[model samples]
Target: MGTLGVLGLELVQMDTPPTTAYLQIYTEERCKANCLFCAQAKDSRAGLTHIARGMYIPADLDAVVSRLKMAYEKGYLRRACIQTALYDKWWEDTVYLIKSIREKSDIPVSLSVFPLGDERYEELCRLGVNEIVIPLDACTPGLFDKIKGKSAGGPYAWERHLDGIKRAARFFESVGTHLIIGLGETDEDAVKIIDELHGYNVNTALFSYTYVPGAQLVLETNKEESIRHYRTVQMARYLILEGIVAYLDMRFTDGALCDFGAQRDVILRLIEDGTAFQTSGCPECNRPMANETFSMMYNFPRKLNDKEIASVKKELGLG
Candidate 1:
């Protein structure tokens, strides 16, 4: 029963059987940002326990490497990801850990660190890191501040995160971002952000906001928010990457998605490909059990079965 840390939440062993895919490891100590929604926020005394929700204590560097080696040898884990927080001195430790992991593990490694500069980005790329995740939680800066209020760095500026993503895309082979739903943003805004990310060839992983038990900010997330965001993101992904439609071609009127600007058949065809299903992002980064089970599953985290895809297509009205 190895302990896995996320933000400030520590997870026990898996409640369900472990799948033979990617293994998520908490590779850092505390986070530097106090995103209001985060359970790891310094002032947040939330009793949340989720693997992807927050940062964890940085395990010994050598031991993390050893554990990964042993896990890989036993065929328990395939790809490994190191999810880090934005600690004050976090970058040095993270840089070292990334280098160390590259030296030991033959498996591809991905990182979820803060928005670092071009130099560090290039350094990691040179050291053989394949993917990096920068989580821009809200659609806009004001929303970002409201959602990630009064933190140490105040709130993450949306433009800065975008700039980071742009820089990263130029350097790294795979650049990704995380967008959380239920933050009062409309589905159109969510889609726009996804389109914007696609412009940089940056992949996005979608999340639904799950309230921590004792977090400072007490916002309630609706289950419908997750469903709508998932459906819209799936659509946005196909539209952007497949070049089915442009963001300007879509419009939101009175809270309804309008102006798809493409033929009904074309849109349906793309949607039918199951690319519009919940499994979006880099190769093999499906994080099942990544979010709260009680809420709507934000990302399917795996390939959707036929019935599930049909259900999503029907729900999205992609006929």
Candidate 2:
């Protein structure tokens, strides 16, 4: 089969627009895992962006960087981030490519590489990388394996990913992970995971699960469930960051987020604290159009406008 080519343009919002840059390119190879919910998983061979949520369409690496360079030189985007997929240990080329861009460009570079050990991470840091994102796609071991099927040796070790994040955070000013919703994980599960990451001083970017064709788990998820998950995660982040609530005090009933050990009004205040607007992945990394659709935003490219914040709050009955 022929290789997939670069796709279309997407307009996005940023907490502070004209400051952060985003670009997502194809991995150029299929992922080795058999993650049931993903399109790029083994045997699927579907489009690249289809495999993961919150990633933009593929683009010619050089062209995208060229445009970003111009933007940075003109003071449009001060920082740029490059995120890629990992089928295994075959991402050396990707690292090299990002390193090359970092060398020639004045903008800060961030990478969301796989859980390669400290050796590769240390190398990237030396190469002028400002941040790294290790997406611990699942919170628990069983869920990790159930969704992200084992290959080579096995799916990512939960403890190991945490250890890696903790270690990376200590050295880097900004370190992050991506957590997708609707993975059969409870709202509580998602909240607790982000809470725990915050405890370790690791930042989290939350994503609502996106379904595509040819996946084993093709069942439709309740829209309310997805919205609820996003709101809870967004709120949990605010609470934790504001020191209003602890992870242990958060409560859930039957997979729904029930309480954050705070008054209702306090939770609302936290949501509006712009804590939700804090960039999730990497320092100065704002991925506009990262999730494909503007309305179905995985991350708010810009700070939430009055309309958006009010709309989301109303949907969750928080308004």
Best by TM-score: 2
Model 1: CA > 4 A from native: 1-30, 47-64, 70-76, 149-155, 265-272, 292-295
lDDT by residue for model 1 over 161-224, one digit each (tens)? 7788888888888899887777788777777887887888888777767666666566665555
For candidate 2, give the lDDT: 0.66
> How does model 2 score by TM-score?
0.81
Stretches off by above 4 angstroms in model 2 are: 1-20, 25-27, 49-60, 87-91, 151-155, 272-279, 292-298
Error of 1 at 251 (Å): 3.2
lDDT of each: 0.65, 0.66
Query: Model 1 reaches what TM-score against the true structure?
Result: 0.80
